[model samples]
Each structure stands twice: as structure tokens, then as C-alpha cells.
Target: MAVEQNSLIENYSIVIVNVAVAVIHYQDQYLLGFRAASQHQGNRYEFVGGKIDAHETATQALIREVSEETGIDIANNIAVKLGRLHHDYGDKRVCLQVYRIEVTAQQYQQYKNLSQGLEGQKLTWVEKQKLLAGDYDLPAANKTILAWLQLPTQISITYPLEHFNNASNPMTVWVQYHQEHLQIGALVYIRIKETGTEESINQLLHLRNDIKAIIPYNFYTEKADNTVINRQIVARHLTQAQLMQCSNGIAKNDIPDFIIASSLPLVVSCHDKESIDAANQLAKACLKHQLAPVIGIFLAPVEYTQTHPDTSPLGWEAWSRLAELADIPVIGLGGLSPVMSDQAMLHGGVAVAGIRQFFK
Candidate 1:
């Protein structure tokens, strides 16, 4: 009996890399599966997934799980890996690899007849509001996974307009350099000055042309009022002063869906708890206005930054705690670069954001 107990202990000691979960979204609703009463944590609701086999990759496991549990077969390249969650449940540890399953409108309609493919389990679609309201109970381990689902994988902020006078030559060189080395999908930000001379505007126009030549990528201006070329808007913080500044010229109705038929995400920055709280409140307000909620919340000063070395940082531990409270995806800014992307993701940041790293 002692030897058997030891064997069981050894089994638990080994890390479990078998499980994969899916954050299946159709429109604004998330597809969730209810567990059977006979299973562990029975009757509780969670994302649909199953254990991976030795021969299968993480993506393969998710494809199989979706088909087996939901009677839906996702096409290849439809699912994007969000990240992974490693949690210890006393008996065993699970590394839950999460993926975001995106489908076209027609493809989604084709799966309308999808049902609960597994016996003793049921399926339902929950809207974002209901899910955020905490109406449906979920396992504690899923708290982090839910947060990860809302995060952007990577983000790049460009230097302000002052950095380049001839936007074509330098900007073209910059794009070519990045394309050859690091092929990353990032939401690029082109920092435009609020008040610019006619020459600067023309230069920006030329720069915009240079960016568009790449095709199949997204870029936006930093200045809120410069909406002529600003495809997406970013509200730095929710302080009354900053909020008023960010919303000064823009109408309330012009947000969330500023551009029709495009997924424009609003990025908001937060430095401390007060701003984070205000950001959440602002998100709720946007929801009320039917505007897109804050998609990225950047918490800064995780480490002492070269930009602001005098200011004390929140450090990694505190930043992680605050990140978990954010209702939207949070990115770690200040003293971070693309090299720290994995560390940022591990410590609750959806992506690593920096001004000097990517810009300089």
C-alpha cells in the first residue's frame, strides 16, 4: 500500500501538459460547456477542452476537443493561441493551453447546429456582459484564463512625428528591417502631434502611404484629435483631466464603432490602482454608450525604466496583482521590450509594451 501511495505521489509530481482549452467566440458571445455531475468539479461551467495525447500538438488537441465536445470542426488556421495557464489543483498540476477560435460570419452560421457532442454535458453561449457580471460560476483556475482571452498578443508604439521629417525614406527602411527579422503581428501606433504644420501633415500623409504599402496590417495615430489618419484612439488614463482631454473634440457616439465593419480596440493606460479603477468604470460607461470597451490596459513601471529611472516602479509582484483586477487585457509598460514578451505574458500581461524599446 505504501509503494502504491508513493507511485501515485510520483505521478502527481510530474507536470501535466495534456490539457488544452478553447475560447470560442461567435460575435460577442463565448461558448462554454457545463461539466457532468460525475466528473471532477462536477456541474460547474468552463471552457470546452480535453486532455492531449502524446502524439498530438497543442493545436491538434484543441481541434479534437472542439469537435468531440461541441460537434463543431474548426478549419485549420482558424484558432490563434492566446497563452497557457499552469495551475496546481493539489492532486495534480495542469498546463491549460488556451486558444482563441475566430471564425467568419458564414463559417459561424454553418456551425449553428452544433450541439453537446459529449454525453452528460450541455453547451450554452454567454454574452460578454453576462460573463463579466460573474452570473455564471466557473472554476477558480479560469480567472486568469478569462483575463488572457481579452488580451492582445503583441503591440508596438512608434516614435512621435518629431522622429522623422522625411517619413518615406526612414519609415520604409524601418518596415523592411522588421519584416526580415521578426515577423510579429502588432497593432502599430503612429504618434501624431496635436498641432502640426502643413509640411508635417504632408509628411504624415506620406508616412501613412508608406505603411499602407505593407497591406494586411493595422496602424493608428496617438493624438486623439488627429482622427483624419488615426484609425484607432487611445485614452492614456481615466483621470477627469486626461479623460476630458481625450474626449474633447470627439463625440460620444463616434466611439467603439468609429469605423464601420472594423474591430477597432480602445487602448487605455493606467499607472496605479486609482487609474485602474477609473479605467474599469470608464469601460462600463463605454458599454452603456455602446462603444467598444477598453481592450488594452497598460500598467507601467514594472521595472526601473531608462525613461523614468527616478520614479519608483510598482515592481513585478504588485503589477501582477493589479493586472488580475483589470476587466480588460493589460500590458506591462515601462522598462520593458519585445524581448520580455514571454515574461510579461507569464506575469499577467497580455503583451509587453514600451516606448523606447520598439521606437528607439
Candidate 2:
């Protein structure tokens, strides 16, 4: 027993060993495995790993698991321990030891076939921004893993447009990224919300030439309308499939970028909690796509404080949390005046988004 223990701990000065894990990166995305539906925490994305086998070293376990799941074998010389995480799940406690592994293109290609359903699992490569956007449900343990793997890398393209007096005038823009010019196959989307006017919709459609596709919100019934509401009108009017195909066009390109989903707010009877939650969710989703920064027009209610004094303040907190979680800029919309712009950012926003303030 003493000799066996000495063998496991031979090279290590530290006596205690922790369960080890590995984070695999490909094209600025981390490889994650989806836990299939089971009695345990299934349907959540998790790092590919398992408990270290008895008498086996963490490095040995990592190499084995990587080979099992990804088919790409890591040279023992290349595997390096990045960090470790200690966390407690509801049912079980785990100490996840993490490593950083680098692989060559040839090795990746060779292992691609063997990388399927290792330990009977599904896998995916998710970009850091998408991971932060929180679209897919992740296990609690994986969240900690993600926070540690957050590398400082520029993975987004930003296009800043100069405002023109004539909406029809081609908007001069600067696309900022390491790449000089966008590839031919890159797809962009131009989206607009209905402001109860056909002219606005037409103006947005005209901008479609600059983008690969356009999506317009067309199905909205006024509260005063006693007639049956047609939800399908929005679906029918929008070219969703075309938009999706355009969005997917990036796969063929060496590097892909997108711009989609603009926002325009119309006056409604109430700014309820549900509406605020939905808006928060949408904002997070948009940031995940790294779409053009949204410009929202907040139509203030006639009697703002009377109906939603309590709820109005909560929106700031919700927006703050979303910004923190998603690490994306948000421009506050409702009741924002020039005087309040600075305060809004301090609370949690990029700038004020309102027709009166922004248009001027």
C-alpha cells in the first residue's frame, strides 16, 4: 500500500490529489458535452471529464478522457494544468481539476471520427460570448468552469454607422475587427420593429441591400381592438427561414459575422414585470449573437409613476444583472432624459434609448 501510494504521488510534492478536468478550445470556442436525459443532471452542458481512476494520475485521467470523448490524443508534453475548481452540487461534491491542452489540425482531423459519443455523450463547441449569453442550460459546475476559461480575446465585429439627415442616404460605416474586409459569404441581418407606420417599415426594407436579410415585426394588435388577434400575421410577414439561412451562410466562409434584430418600442397600456423579463431575455440573446447594438425607443406612459412606481425601479436592477451576466452593453429606454443618461450608465446601461433624446 505504501509503495502503491508512493507510485501515484512519486513526482508530485503535494500529497493530496484532486479530480482533474480539461477544457478543449477550437476556433475560439470551448468544447462542451451535453448530458443526455437521465435521472442525474441531464440536458445540461458540461466539461468532458470524470473522476480520476484509482492509482491513476490526474494527467493520465485527462489524456484518457480527451481521447475517449474527442478522439484527439494530447501529447503528454503538451498537457498543462491551468487551474482547479472546488464546488458542491446538491447531491454530490466535486473538486474539478482543469488543464489546458493544445492540438494540431492534423491531429484534430484524424480524431474527428473517434470523437463521437464517448461515454455515450453528445458534444458541441460553444464560443465564449455565446456561453456567457446563457442560451443553453448549463450545469452549475460548468458555470464555474466557464468563468475560469474566460480568455481575453476579441471575437466580435463592430460596425459604427454615422447618422445621416436623409434616411435613404447610404449609411457610411466602419467595420472594426482584426480582419480587413468581410468575406463574401458573411451574412448580415437588418431587423425593424413596427411603429404603427408603413413608411417606417419601408425605410427598414430599403436597408436590406446592406444586409443579407431583413426581419420586421408586423403582428401587433392595439388594446382597443376588440377583434380576434392574429399572431400568425407577424410570422407570415417576417422572412424567418430566409433569415436563418442567411445567418447560417457563415459556415461556408472562413470567418463569419452577422447583424440582426433591431428594436423599436411602441406605447402600450402597461410596463409589467413580464414585459420587463421578456425584454431582458431578448437583450441577452441579442448580445450573444453580437448583433448590432440595439437602439430602443421608449415611449413613456402618460401617468408613469402612478401605475408602475415600484416596478420601474426594478427594471434598473434587472438590467444591471443582465449586463453583469452577459457582459454586454445596454441602453436604457423608459423615461430617460438627457439629465439621466449618466446616472443610467452608473446604474447599468450604455446610454439612453429614447426617440426624443436619441433622434435629436
Candidate 3:
């Protein structure tokens, strides 16, 4: 079994262990068990499995847990190892060894009789079609099982905000897969408006020299002077769709670790309350879907409006609450001098994002 340690604040360490999970499907319906309320993730739907006890091999543990939980005596020869799953539950982690098992009619009947009136565990057979409909709130480990069971599809990539908007450094994005580093793919979407100027776009191209293909921003403007601005805005909107489509297209494609919307404040005025509200809603929805985390960048103006109330920079409290509810990481942007990174972290952000401050 592989061991992984995840470090959290205050010296807390999360430990993950590897074990095996068995899937017994009959007529396209997979067997599942509801965990007892007393168990760590009580009441959640999970595959039939448990931690491998001392001196026991993975196969032995799988056999023992299946018998203990489902009362099914699976013949050793009938169990087939499928693959492995790595899961982290904040406090602990588990690498699941997956297996597919076959059960005969006679064995099912005998197991049914033995499992009757069992305490804490509720067993059921769920159709694969219904399972794919996303009806149940399953544990992370179970989700890995389902992914393995499903047909192979394109990889999905998601680019969150934190990766790109480093205040002190010119914008850059990191990509990852299964928490491992990966290079960007050929087709990349660059938001022209977010890049602001042709020079900036060229600079970005230089930074991502490895990329051979890029979908440039096409502006929409009736006037000559505003052509660039229009194109940028159009590019921004298109980039959003491109990012989403890329994320849903291939699971193997490395998800961008961050997206740099702009080094400057994208919203020129705080008075656009509707835009702020819409952004918040979108962020919330993404979080609900387990999409990438969002970081709001607040590039401060050179001068402050004396008439405005003395509010914390960028209404930090409001954004912090929204991110917290969605379990999304938020990094404060704008006027984030190097010294303020600590303060931003204290305010529930992973870190501060800034060009001047980041490089400094």
C-alpha cells in the first residue's frame, strides 16, 4: 500500500492508505453499500471494501471485507483486479485497489439470507445508467470507482484564477493532472481583451513558446479606436467557453492550474453591482460542480475616492464568505504588496496574487 501525507496548517497531517474495493455487477446493475452513521463518512454510498488489516495481502483484505460486509463468499478465482484509485479526504487518504467479482444465482441467494437484518449496512443494486445520472452524493473513493467503470472519454481541463494572476510577476499559468504537473496542449485560448494590448499578447506568446497553436482574440467594434477593445471583450467571452469546453473534452488533458484574467482590475467601477453579483454566482456554481477554484483580483486605483466609505480593499469580506461557502480557494488581488500576502492568507485566501508584489 502506498502512503501519502498531506500537510495542513497547525501541524495537522492527513494520512492515506491503499486498499481494495470489489464491484459485483449483475445485468448492468452494480452492488453498493450505504455506510453506517457511526463510520467516518457515515451514510454515504460506498463500494464494498475496507482497510487491509495487518499481515493481510490486498486480495485477502478484499475477500474478507466483502464477506464481512455483504455476507458473500467470493471464490478466490472469481475476483479480477481492475485498477487502483488514489483518494484524499482532508484528514486521511486511501489508495483503493479495485476488483470486479462475479456472483452466481445460488451464491446470491445464500448471501441474501446471511445478510438479512445486518446492522448499519444497507445493500442495494443500482443500474449503471441511473448511476451515471448523478443522483447520489457519493464518497470520493466511490467516485473514483465509477470513473473507472465508465467508458473512456476525453480528458477535462479547468483553469482557475490563482495560477495566472501573480501580482509581482507577469501573468503565467500552470497546468496539472491528478495533482501532477503537465505541459499545456497545442490548442490554447488567449483572451485578447484580458491581455489588453498587442504588446501584452506578444509577451504572452513569448512566455508560452512551447505552444504551437493558439486561438487569437477577434474583436467586435464599429469604430476604429474601439476595435481593439471590442476584440478583447469578444476574446474574453470566447475564452470562457473555450476553457469550459476544454475542461469537459478530455480528462487526460492537464487542467490549467490558474487563469490570468487581467493584471489590472477587469471591473473599472465598483458601482457595477450587477456584474459583481453575476461573478459571485458563477463562482458559486463552479464550486458546487467541483470545478476549479476562483480568485478575484482587485487592482487598486492610484488614488482613492474620499467620498467612498472606508471599506476593506475590494470588499474582501463579501468575496471571502462566498468562496468559503463554495469551498473554493480565493486569493486577494490588486495593491497586494509583498507584505500583504500574510494578511490575505489570514483572510481565508490561499495567497495574494499580484504582479508588482509577487515578483518583489
The models' CA-based lDDT, in order, is 0.58, 0.41, 0.45
lDDT for model 2, on a 0 to 1 scale?
0.41
Per-residue lDDT of model 2, residues 19-88, tens digit only: 6677766546667778878835787877777667776667787878777776667744354343344344
* Quality of model 3 by C-alpha lDDT: 0.45
Cα lDDT for residue 204, candidate 1: 40
Error of 2 at 335 (Å): 51
Give a tens-digit lDDT track for model 3, residues 258-296.
223221111111122343343444433333345432323
At residue 142, candidate 3 shows an lDDT of 61
Clashes of each: 1, 1, 23
Candidates in descending TM-score order: 1, 3, 2
TM per candidate: 0.47, 0.37, 0.40
Off by over 4 Å in 2: 1-18, 111-115, 153-360
Q: Highest lDDT among the candidates is held by which one?
A: 1
Ranking by lDDT: 1, 3, 2
